[model samples]
Target: MSMIKTIKSLPMAVAAAAVLAALPMPEGTPIFGEQTAFAQRAESNKKQSTRKVQALTADFHKKLQKAQEAIDAKNYAEGMEILDDALARKANDYERAVAWQLKAQVFYEQDDVRGTISAYEKILQFADSIPEALEIGIIYNLGQLYYSEEDFDKALEYIQRWQNRVDPTLISVSNLQFIANLHYVRNEFEECLKYIYQAIEIGNSLETVEVKESWYSIALSSHWELGQYEKVRDVLEILLINWPKPRYWTQLAGIYQELGDEQTSYSLTEAAYKQGFLDDNETQLVNVAQIQLARSAPIKCAWILEKAFKENRVEKSPKNEKILGQCYMMAYEYEKALEPLSKAAAGDEDGDLWFQIGQVQMQLGHYKDALDSFASVIKAFEKDKSEKAKEKTLSATMQRGQAFTELKRFKEAREAFKTAKRMATDRRDKRMVTQWESYLKAEEAREEMLNG
Candidate 1:
């Protein structure tokens, strides 16, 4: 929070006055008298003010020289104390202002934010003109303080005020970076986009590569937050065309994902990963695979999933394994589906995953395996800890019994239906179980009679 040390106040006032006068004033406005009145008054009241200030400034300069001598002599604290006293005794407003500004610098060296802010405010009140640099410096500190205190409106007020005063043409790369961060912290996404774009514009005029690349990321992210997906796409296209970084590809993939274009998302992400854009994080890769599943490109989805799974580079959590299983099943690769599906089913006490696994196995003519999976589900809910689980478990068991019957294991199917009929407490469940059991028994009797 160091104060603006070299204000160049005289030049700033002259520039501001020139800009103001150049504007079309009223038809009869006299510029010279109107502007000079305030300047004249300040001069009159302090006729010897300049001389007094100069003398005081020389004294402070001498003290500062001695303080530097002490510092060079390895007496740090004593040097600081002497400098503090010199600041306290300044003779007039202008001289006093510089003293406070200098004190702020000293305090900043010691990391004393409280002293720094206090001294900065005194300088702001007494300085001749608020230089653009000084305005930016002080307002930036005020914005930070207000933000820390949770006073967002005040924070926004000062930051925007400072931004308005800064010359766009003179905004260096570092200044633009600072401005970008301030807008981001305020969550003014639109404003962030505007200034960041301005930075890009300036960088392009100067042919500055670093700032231009930075603006691409800033523009992409801000547009993403605003749900302006098309703008993000456009910015990414330009970035790819010009700079062609890995981030451009990854961001393009993310934008396509938002646009519900999963194939493009997958292609872009794959390109990024191949080109080494996406890091070991693999977040973009995961998103692309997931979106492919959503788009029903199951073979491609499974291919991506299997690559990540086999590499052990990314942890294959059970949920992701389940997705891979579903993809494989959709791709008609049932044998590959079985391993991940089985792991997902057995890894948790989830009735739905178990049901899905059983249904897939049944479709593949693995009736015995299907029956076992569903049987485990039924046993898991036998005590009926959750009513919802109980109903699901019963339904799955009934379906498994039907699957067994299709395999001509009629005796086991009959026993399963009988057990379920006895266990069912809800009237609807009881009725369903009774009907199924009766049908099974009738079928068995027909088989026996035919044999006889």
Candidate 2:
């Protein structure tokens, strides 16, 4: 089975917005809410320490204010120019960090991801001088930026750096899921499972939370990749309860089959079919039919294939027709078997199909059709000198003699028995031919007596 590839990571804008929301706003800028945890901690430390906090110079502050106004007005180009000019001047570490922060905002406004990442990395260069809250936010935002750029390795690196600095209890479910997604994309299944299970456990523990479907999806794909079918089945059961998508139902049924629970597999697949989930999937429909036939429900199998054929969902290829024909024959629906059997027989080159068709014709007492079917079987093997082919030819000839006898064509019956005797190598086969010849003579004499 192909791995499910859906991911539910936050979009770049949303991730960036989250980072921007958590950090301290520039001077004279509007604060959206309370200060960040790191910001509050830094403020408390500042109060306890005698050392002075670094401040931006008046000239640098003026340029920063001008850039912020241009940005607030949606004048991205002017905002970028002013931030670039401020960064060009020789400034203190704190001033450079603030300028880069404003530049990152400008790049973000212009939807320039590379520029945004560059600006954020520039701020990180001043990590020792910048506020702890600002530095941590930049690191986390860089991870999200790299992810948006599809640089998964760099994304994971930066995200791990951010995680190390933050308290373990402060990490949210979304952060765990994001880390899990990074691991999944990198093919680190074991690590992916570790983080995903953590996220699932945390989310499930919350009274008001509904776990995201994509979390279970990641677990399902991770287990499948690791060849842990039992775990995959467990995740799929949860998905079926919460999501109940058609794909989840079919995939769960497949997982049951992989785990060697054929009975459960059949039951689940049949249930999905009853719900009309398998109607559009021809291969799966045919698989369910095969399982039904194996479980001795040939009538059910035939009904499925017959319906599929009528709806044009399944191709009426010789192989499919042969399966349908066999299903009907097993169910004792000889008359219904003839159409598909004849079509399948007509397309076969090996004569085995014709032999089966001949048997069905004999069951229906259609001696002429049976005679023709047996003749085709014999003709199909006439050129093959293999022992298996010769055996089939001999069997067809014997059946043909019976067909002729039933039609009152005693002369043809005698010729067919003569042909069979020539081909019979086994003592048992020779004995059977002898018995048939004796019956032919007795039948011929009985007919003569009746005519006289």
Candidate 3:
């Protein structure tokens, strides 16, 4: 009953890469409180104290400028060392704070995350009191770093806190973009839609294509997840108006499938296949056949598969063969089912296909053949070396054993049930074993009575 379909959107990494241009700061400062802080500093300073602080600030400023020059030349270690010496020297609180900010920027540029975080933490602790803008900017950068690390929880923690500090009406598109991405990463699709829509609303008022495209991307994924097929169709109609591509065809086909509109799904899928939207040429042909079969159009299904085979489009894939077998079974061509069913059973050697083959054989009145097929499936499953497989094997064995008992093969049936009892670990299987033990005893008693 699951309606899960192929993802229409790119992988998170690709989407992340694609939306980079929409992001505001990327890895830079979020705000600038330094100008206001400088104003306050000027107002509060006495002449003598201001003179001493200004001289120290001038020296630190010169050292910071030289460090920037070194950094520009790609001598990061040398630049950081010079900045370190400046911070270590006769520096007041303000100079030390600016030196830490420079140090953080240098480490961020060098992609040393831990070093950058450490320096940023120092900047926020000391500089936040003097410069609120720098504090917000540092926190925003921390959000970016956490996101890069794929740490959604920490990223949200920082970004949400930053959002709380900033005015919503004044919030930049970049901030909203990061928040939307953070929500997407956390699978909080609802929150993601809210923010992305808000960004779109804001962008529409300003008429920015950047935010419009972001809106389209969000709408596509959100509608798809919510199974709003009509909305998906409508949005895709608009998308194709601008970018008429095969991507929409496939997505629309899947959505139609979810809506139980078989003919439309079939039509769209065929169009996609013909247009080379389906890369697996043979598999796509078979998929079209499956859609027909699901619609009770087995004749159409058979024709498509036959054409696929004749054109060398079909691979000798187990999946394709299984589909072909099921198609033949539905068409009441049990004889035709034999070859594909046998091949599939051998290829997978799994319990399900074996049971399927057994069912087909039984329908054809080949009871002994059915018994053998089911037994093979049971034995193969038992030897699979997987605990879950073994559990499945036990269930298959029990079913096969019951079939044998009904066919009056009591000895084999008893043996199969006994094997199931030994292999089974689940409570349900244990109860089945107990029931079969009583059945086996009853069968033995009836045989004894007959002989007596």
Candidate 4:
């Protein structure tokens, strides 16, 4: 299961908007090596001079460069023919690696995934013969190719190699964020966090939201999986500030709930509701009401739930009706509570809804209505085997006794109390039933004396 539940339906934070941030260096300066590669450049220049004296090998190199240019010009057949001629001659591994790299580019341009992969792998096999800069470039592009094909394992493997080779300052924050996303897809959340936070820091310094969504998503999910609720909230807050979407708001409030901070959760959901972000979502609307109810604001809870139900914004299911009924009862709106409570109880077999209805009726001084609700509770309990289920039965029978006593029905009150005693599931409950019976007997004697 994904630790961040809300991300699944949202836009996937792929590396779609990635852009490499680089220095405005001299044209030939390698991205990973500024002046650090000067010795390698000098040695390469010496190699060029050495190759220039050998006419045949020099011709092979020039033909390979022409092939690359041909491929770039969309002349694939010409490029392949030149490359075949160049390869038919005896060539060094370095020259062959360059030829394969160009071949891969042509195949990629034609959307030949298998050919691109094969060519790239062939180039990597000459790893020792390839220049350091070209090696890093090849590994990075390999990661990109595998990622494009959704082969995340190979993509991550090559990307990690590229990351290992580069100067951290040279690679774009977007690339780092992409690596983080790969880790996220693979469920290596801890490593995902390491790279994503680096990406976020770089992105913050650069002041770009281009891949910020992806960075924050990976961060949020990673922190959540690590059980770092506060960090999860931090990422969510960043996303909410920049994005301000309903989903982020809900996720932010949900993280608050996970942290056991209902006050913050309730306030945050209320904020979303006030901003009209949650008005159209039934689950969000219900969440808002639940938060309000938790905070002892049942009037607001009932108002939101009742209006949503009436406006057809939310479904009027039995479970929802029960919640609505409870909201009304908590708000002391017994008359309004009765309708949904009755509807809920009518459809429920566990008797919990009936117990709720009886509580509401008893509070409203409706003794007969309360008695009927308790009867339903008892009948439901008759078929239930668990002692936990029987708990409600004991409470309902005792309530029935109270209802009978209130209606001045002494014989029925004694009978109800006797049933309560028989239904009790434990010594503690049995003692409570015994006390109710004693109280009922005293009331009976007092009533008989008064009548005499």
Q: Worst 10-residue stretch by lDDT in candidate 4?
A: 14-23
Which pairs, if any, clash in model 1? Answer: none
Per-residue CA lDDT of model 3 for 345-442, tens digit only, reads: 78877577887788777777677787788778767776578876776677677867767766778888888888888887878888978898788778
List where candidate 2 sits over 4 angstroms from the true fold: 1-53, 69-75, 348-350
In model 3, which runs have C-alpha deviations exceeding 4 angstroms? 1-56, 128-131, 211-247, 279-283, 294-299, 310-313, 318-452
The backbone clash count of each candidate, in order, is 0, 0, 2, 0
Most accurate candidate by lDDT? 2
Model 4 deviation from native, Cα RMSD in Å: 8.4
What TM-score would candidate 3 get against the native? 0.57
Q: What is the lDDT of every predicted structure here?
A: 0.64, 0.80, 0.67, 0.73
lDDT measured at residue 100 in model 2 versus the true structure, 0 to 100: 74
For model 2, how does the per-residue alpha-carbon lDDT over 76-155 read when each residue is reduced to its tens digit? 88888998899888888877877777777666666677877898898788777755655666777678767767899899
TM-score (C-alpha, index-matched) for candidate 2: 0.85
lDDT of prediction 3: 0.67
Candidate 2 structure lDDT:
0.80
Residue 95 of model 3, lDDT score: 62
Q: Write the per-residue lDDT of candidate 4 for residues 1-452, one digit (tens) a residue.
A: 33122212222221110111121223442232122222233344322222211112556557856875787679999998998888888887766765676676566566576687788788778766645554566567667667666689998889888767766656666567777777888889998998888877776676555555767777888888888899989888989998889989889989888888878888889999999888789999988888778889888888898889888988998778888888888998889989987888787664887888898789889999999999998898888888857888889989999999988898999998888887776899889888888888888889889999
Q: Put the candidates in TM-score order, highest first.
A: 2, 4, 1, 3
Put down candidate 1 lDDT per residue, 1-452, tens digits, no spaces: 23222121111211111211211223443331132222332334332223212223455556755765665465758877886787677355544554454455555555454565566666667534422244345655555544444456776787677557544444455456546655766677888887787777776677544555656777777887888999989989998998987777877877787898877877788677767565465566666667677777888888877887787655677777787888888888888998887887777766678777788778888888888879777766777778788777778878777876877789778877876776588899888887887777787788889999
